[model samples]
Target: MAEEETELSDEQKKEIAKWFLLNAPAGEIQYVAKDLKSVLNADDVYNEAASEAFPVYNKSHMICLGMSGHFGDVLVTSYGELNENEYLDPKTAQVAIVDHVKQVCTEVRPATDEELPSPYIEEYRCALEAEMLKYVSEAYPKGVCSVYCINGKDAEGPGSDFELVVVISAARLSPQNFCNGSWRSIWNIEFKDDIQSLELKGKLQVGAHYFEEGNVQLDTKHECRDSTIFQSPDDSAIAIASVIRHHETEYLASLEESYLNLPDTTFKDLRRKLPVTRTLFPWHNTSQFSLTREISKELGIGK
Candidate 1:
């Protein structure tokens, strides 16, 4: 008779998962027959593992899973990475696993050179970043310089370690008064291998309106459009410009739709006419629309 195989408990499974995530060699693809729920239950473990294994501050290590029944050597099909937030999402993990199993496992063979992580990824990232920066500078003369990409905590607390930022601003007067207008957009660019994750965050103000619509949040329409994926940093920078230009057009449309024929329109009325919806920040009573516009225009974004 054949000997019975021992079954692993949830704890044991997590332990095994943590071990592989923590110690797996960079660019190596290791196979585990059982489906361990480690990726789901262990947030701290993933954070720790990524902290140790992340190729760079802007890039995350990739994780792939195999199905339970297969027994051949796991062959890595591609090389890529995700942001920490993207990596930790259970749905993303599941998709990667299922995709991997579907793409390979029918034959036994070593991963090809193309499937392996780049040997000089650090230098590669630096070169890519330089090219991206140059592109931003040349393509967007109005794009403001910022230190938001710095790698460490700020005086307030932890800060985003984004690789680059493109701040774009646009404003127009009431066609009569200099004190009336709207618009600002900022894109945080996190560079990955052959891809750039662009996050949109900014503020919108209307003529003499007290409330300001700002930041991408769950309840906002812009939230869904917040994170855009691009093939290159140059394309991502162009996207930033495109978003600002769209805002300019939207602002004009809002003026025509909401302000025309209506006298002394309130902020709420103007916002209702805008194309995009966003959370209105009303925390402080002193926050004025005219004031916000002045500050934004004078200092500009990324200052």
Candidate 2:
């Protein structure tokens, strides 16, 4: 079912306009106007603004004037990332914002040969020479950085003694052009023969929804799997298990805090806490890609 839109109040407009005026990128600031309405989209924009520091690009860009084409109240959309300053006409504001996005797109580029084989990749290559060198020489996986490539790394983990090293390779792509959200550009570690060295058959992908939104500060606690780390044939199991621990911790915490201030906290509630059944032994799938499926689906990447 579609939810009804709630209109913003006068106080809300004042707060929003205040924010827009303050963060308008040094010279982008124009004269502040009186009547701007704030549009809400579920919880992606406003609630996120209250809790997190998101990038400017993640905010809304489309500027819609209410038919008459004159500014009643100057507009403020998004959370100051892409703004239509009150000083310009609606059409001019939209054009200026589009150009701003174009400026941002120019900065994102595929890693070059000198850029590939990152420090982590170099570290892995130093560990095993024959497998890595042989794979690179034969595969020649060179196009876009993520295309025709291998990535390997010793994932520094918490708790366990397993020194897990993972490698992933995708050889069937050309150019594979990635935008801001594409896994190729977002992940900090990009390796060149890490996958080919391990001889794994799994497909590798680095797509993300947040990647396109361009917010680097959002918490990845909801991410069930780290794609590059999880696709490693050798280390995926241990890496996923580690992720499960974090997931379950967050899950349990959420469960405990829910339904606060309920009036039923009496002797009956105490009785509910008593155990009536034997402890159920737990079992886990220990799967990597299984956890990442949702992330991939949301990002429109295939299995």
Provide TM-scores for the models. Answer: 0.26, 0.22
How big is the positional error of residue 302 in model 2, measured in Å on the Cα after superposition? 73
On TM-score, the candidate that comes out on top is 1
lDDT of candidate 1 over 1-303, digit per residue (tens): 997799656556555555664432222222221222244465554444334333331122222223334331111211122222221111112112223322222222233433322333223233433444454455444332221232221222212233443333222323222232222334444444334455545443222322134322111112213455644334545565565446545655765665465544565466555444355555575558668878888886523
Q: lDDT of all predictions, in order shown?
A: 0.36, 0.31
Among all windows of ten consecutive residues in candidate 1, which has the lowest summed lDDT? 86-95
**What does candidate 1 score on TM?**
0.26
lDDT score of model 1? Answer: 0.36
Pull out the clashing pairs in model 1: none
Candidate 2: residue pairs that collide: 56-81, 150-193, 150-194, 167-195, 168-195, 181-211, 183-206
Off by over 4 Å in 2: 1-109, 117-233, 244-249, 252-257, 260-303
Model 2 C-alpha lDDT per residue in residues 69-108, reported as the tens digit of each score: 2322122223112233221212122211222321122111
